[model samples]
Target chain A: MAITFPVEASHILMFARAVGDPNPVYNPASAPGGVIAPPTFGQAVAQFDPEYHLRPKPGQPWFGSGKTPSGVDKAPSAGGLHAEQHFEYLRPLRPGDVLTVEIKPGATWEKESKRAGKLTFRERIAEYRDQTGELVLIARGVGVTTERPVDQG
Target chain B: MALSASRIKPGDTHSETVVSNLTRTQIVQYAGASGDYNPIHTDEVYTTKAAGYPSVFAHGMLTMGLTGKMLTNYVGDGRLLKFGVRFTNQVWPGDTLVATATVTEVADLVVKLDVVTTNQDGKDVVRGSAEARIDP
Candidate 1:
């Protein structure tokens, strides 16, 4: 699925300041793309996944969908965290650019870990294309869902 | 300034980023800027008193952003094509991080770099690499 949105200088400035980089480069007077977003800005675009587990379901808590407790009581609270991130830019992302992002599932694998045994790794890829339908960037997010801890704290 | 592919060498080293002033304020700003309002990164009370963690930690994306800053400063944003990183360790407030990217290859209009980010005690915090398409 693809989601299209317009890039803005204010978002770039906010993101730059949020990351502690107050360099003048984010200002329109300094660079192309109005406010040339940082290299890693691809992650900030909201993902478009109907089955996104992180999405807050109706009446659900802000952070939880009550899915963890439903998964299995044996499943420890350790859960999983962001394992890796990768981005490929065919062109610079700039303010005022209307881009469409296609989100799709990639490869999945399993690994044996001492802390969380039989960890499962899944990759989500988001391909961003500009208004001209040219591919501008590809961002891959790898999530490693940890197996239930042998010794739950 | 943008670094051209023809100008980079196999052994060229990019400038380094050593951010020692990691504070809760930066984390809060990151949470605000990134729209990643995960309480674990911003709310110290939720993390310490509620979640039972030692303290709030910086977002992984925040660290990745700093690494990008180092690369972009060395070679302007237009030339950067690929950047990737793996979260190796948790970064807590007050821990100084030193990030370095070294040129590994310069061929076919592309420059590859090997990146390593370490904490104050030299513990690896992030390990990854990046590839940028340089202009002639």
Candidate 2:
């Protein structure tokens, strides 16, 4: 099952500022078309409650990952590593435009850990769309979950 | 002088100054501030033998943050359009990163930059590209 999240322009602006991106395009009052959001603004979308828009319907336990940050794993292994990420922008996100994000799992696999434990790699693709169903952005991310014996020191 | 798209030829180079007497505390602060708590980045033991890394390293994004800072500061605001990076190498504690950019392509309103971060040893720590739209 797929999950969707709703985002506010303020959150994106905050994120862009946090990353030190001071581009005026992210400024609502200064942007050219009265200023849209940043090109990378789609990053704020999450598959879980911290950003989830609507709860999954009953019997959709697969979509609920029990508070995992990305909502892709119910119990993420210890020592998660950010592997890679890619983003594509289709249209500018404007202020007052609410984004509906749809997340789809891309792939999941296991490998011998590079850090002396087992590792699980998971990738997901998220699509951000505006109220009128205009595609705004597409984000693909890969995460690494590390597992080591609890008693191994 | 501002480096406008029209002024940059295909091999033009851009450089920005950076200083770092990086402390362990700064590393931890970046981890907390960014919510990226990978143990190898915060814990020394895990980074060395456990993670097979030479030593505790700074967050890739933290270094990217420095690049972002320079880009905005250079463009003098209201001109940058998009920026992103792919992490290539680890930046260890106490290493000062110098970020540089080279013009790859130029359009009427856009300039593409091949940006890179290098340590004092001249080793590239991170490499990426950025696009800035010159405001008329």
Candidate maximizing TM-score:
1
lDDT of 2: 0.60
What lDDT does each candidate get? 0.75, 0.60
Q: Each prediction's interface RMSD?
A: 4.1, 7.9
Candidate 1 lDDT score at position A115 = 58
Model 1: lDDT of residue B22 = 91
Q: Looking at model 2 chain A, which ten-residue stretch has the lowest summed lDDT?
A: A62-71
- Chain B TM-score against the true chain B, each candidate: 0.91, 0.82
lDDT at position A42, candidate 1: 79
What are the per-residue Cα lDDT tens digits for candidate 2 across A1-153? 333445555554565565445566555655565555444445444423342332234454422223332334332234455555565556556666766777788999988844446767899777777888888777777766667522222
| Candidate 1, B33-83: lDDT as tens digits | 666655667666555544445777888888888888888877776678889
Clashes of each: 0, 1
Clashing pairs in 2: A31-A35
Per-residue lDDT tens digits of candidate 2, residues B37-68? 55556666545544445566776666766676
lDDT for residue B91 in candidate 2, whole number 0-100: 69
Tell me the DockQ of each model, to 2 decimals.
0.45, 0.15
